[model samples]
Target: MVDLLKPYLDLRDAEVETDFGIDDPVVYGSRAAIESIFTNLIVNSLRAFAQDYSSGRLESAEVCFRKIIIRTKKLGDRVIITFSDSGPGIREISIDDIWIVGRSTTPKGSGLGLCIVRDTVEDMGGAIRAEAHGELGGAEFTIELPLRN
Candidate 1:
């Protein structure tokens, strides 16, 4: 999935970091849904960075790798996947309302991606949380999915 979005990543001078471990949880769900979860977040990060660049925010900011990091770890019967970026964090929208349809911080966003992400996670017996500024100093999304196969 990361490889598939290389164009977008390269356009924004960013990349993804992660190592799929042998213990990574595997849940039973639609393949497309799983793919959507990742693609949406990556695209969101790209859009956010693009906005910052156009507004001269990134150019003035300190230099960094500008990456998206995805890490997974098994905790009891669930796997916690943290997906984060190194761009300007979520802006404007409250963390509480970020997953709400039509609530968007990006100027051109349709405001539906995160909503679908929330619904899809819930439908798959998973839970998700978002942090505007997280460990990586940008938008962070932590999704916990059941370890059951």
Candidate 2:
């Protein structure tokens, strides 16, 4: 997925860092849905960073202005995955509101991606949450799912 989206990332000088703690943690879910989740999160961060860059919020002096990190770890019975970025954080509204259908912060976004993300996670018997200011100083999404498929 990262390779497929490399052009956009390169265009905006964005970098992606992946941290997979387990060698090959297994989770059984719809392949397409899983890919969609990752894609949506990355794209949303990219869009947010684009806005920041366009508005001159990201200056030459700023460090780590557009980094997206995907980290995964395995617990006794669950797998935890976090996707974060160094762009602007979310709004004052609760993180839950960001998953509402047709709700969007971007100017040209239709707002369907996040809504689908929430639904897909719930359908897979997983739990997902968002933090406005995470380890990356921007928005973060953490998903927890059963280790055994």
Among all windows of 10 consecutive residues in model 1, the one with the lowest summed lDDT is: 56-65
Over 4 Å off, model 1: 22-24, 60-64
Maximum-lDDT candidate? 2
Best by TM-score: 1
Residue 122 Cα positional deviation in candidate 1, in Å, after optimal superposition: 0.5
How does candidate 2 fare on TM-score? 0.89
Residue 40 lDDT in candidate 2: 94
TM-score between candidate 1 and the true structure: 0.90
Alpha-carbon TM-score of each model against the true structure: 0.90, 0.89
